[model samples]
Target: MSSTAAGSPEPPSPRTVTPAVETVLAFVNTRADGTGRRELFEDGDSFADWLAEFGGFGGFGGFDGETVATDADAAAARELRDALVTVLLAHSGDEESLGEPLRHAERHLRRAGSLYPLATVVTAGGVELASPQTGVERVFGTVLAAVTTFAGSGDWGRVKACRNPPCHFGFLDRTRNGGGLYCSPGCGSQVSMRNYRRRLRQES
Candidate 1:
């Protein structure tokens, strides 16, 4: 029975979506906060609620009442999120810092499932990706498809993680040079101030 914020903007129409980048955005936004401490999918019930809300917003289907997420699903989802965070950090040029998490992410990603092209239909839009699975597999498949397609389209570098700790939100870098390093100007400013204070203390 949870609802969107009181003044939240309406989600874009599903028909207008290009799922590649949008799906990745949706998956990453599931975290209640950029800090990763509050997880939207902390359990089966919570996962179900998130799936319901996210599915409606993203216009994704196949995860209705019939799909049953388990405790294992919650665990896998968290693991995947952590792995993604590690990858984002690596993307930010810290590849040497999280080798093990990256490896774990790779293995799990390998098992996520596969995508096959669906016949293009004018009504349904042009050629689209589809997967023949359900439950957690479907979730993994959708996210992986987004990541792969986005990377193939050369937008891989545009997906970035905030440099600010405890607020590592994944965002599409729409900057002219794709040099964005934080989730928002606020985060960037906070980091800047913190760094400035630290340096001042060192000098003092």
Candidate 2:
């Protein structure tokens, strides 16, 4: 529904049906690249702003909007976000795009898991993962819980970052075959054209 930098309308992409998927995408997209680059958790105030915007989402019930974020918390949030982007890049078969090795990213995620462990919650409706911590740590736990839940459903592979450089936007691949590579047709076209030019030069 959004237009690209060139004023072209982006093709309709599949919307995530699960709240878990929505949460993961929202968290990963906070630091999207290219012309739409955004760093939502640059500082304590900015991190607080991000919490105000997405803290009320389904899995984020433990977030305390009133709780203030420290600079340390903001830095941790950025580290977590980058690690997540690395994993999502792997999902899109572009693990090296972010320049962080996948193994390093995995280790960071493991460290994060220990820092913000998720708790199991049972209700009359069903069972779910919830964060016991409050404030920003809770936000991290909830994001991890979302990823775990969606990954358990076998749909985690569908959650991917765009393969196009400088436009590694997070998106849910809803194509029939789950072969989506780019976030939009424009990104795909850009990659194709670049590849074509490279091929021509090589042939020359």
Candidate 3:
């Protein structure tokens, strides 16, 4: 295989995520340089752990001339992570029917109505970047801030909850025609079949 020939070799495909999924993924993947973890939303536990860490601080209150109790910190972290996951996971449907993890996630996302995930700010070498301000970070301060870059932009059309029951979570429909409705194509087919069966039962 040559370096740059289709017949010789193919370049690696790029990893792509729509703006909506990226929002939640960002929260799930934030890294804490203050701690050992170097990346955020890279994995599930880390996402949960970041919430734990963020919630540790009491309402973003910095340790003043006096330091706060360690237990207070832990409690705060728990609240933020749990709240974020909870708000995001809250669904219009029967939320109680969801699995434990899904229930937790829906709870985290419910607050976001037309606007999903929300946004904040992060500075580059000099310029600042808009991002979601994960509430915990604002209370104590953080390198990244929650942002609402996607709010009220008439871009909400792409935002969609996956039709697949298993992944009923939301994602931005990124097909050129903006027709994407599942996290992945396989799930789309699964959902279509499910809907088909549902219609058949109703018709019968």
Index of the highest-TM-score prediction: 2
Q: Tell how far residue 141 is off in model 1, in angstroms.
A: 0.6
Report every candidate's CA lDDT.
0.64, 0.79, 0.41
Give the runs in model 3 whose Cα sits over 4 Å from its true position: 1-21, 28-48, 51-147, 152-154, 202-204
The total number of steric clashes, by the backbone 3 Å criterion, in model 2 comes to: 0
What TM-score against the true fold does each predicted structure earn? 0.75, 0.85, 0.39
- The worst-scoring run of ten residues by lDDT in candidate 2 lies at 1-10
Model 1 error, position 200 (Å): 1.3
- Rank the models by TM-score, top first: 2, 1, 3
Q: Report the C-alpha lDDT of model 1 over 2-80, residue by residue, as the tens digit.
A: 1123456653332233556677767775665655456787898788777777765443565665557887888777767
lDDT score, candidate 2, position 66: 74
Evaluation by TM-score, superior candidate among 2 and 3: 2
lDDT of 2 by residue, 1-204 (tens): 111234445523444456777788888788747486778888888888778776677556544567588888889988998888888888888957445578888899999999999887775545678789877788888889888877766677898888898878888898888899899999999999999999999999
lDDT (Cα, 0-100) at 14 in candidate 1: 28
Clashes of each: 0, 0, 46
Candidate 1 weakest lDDT stretch, 10 residues = 116-125
Q: Over 4 Å off in model 2, which ranges? A: 1-16, 61-67, 95-100
Candidates 1 and 3 compared by TM-score, better number: 1
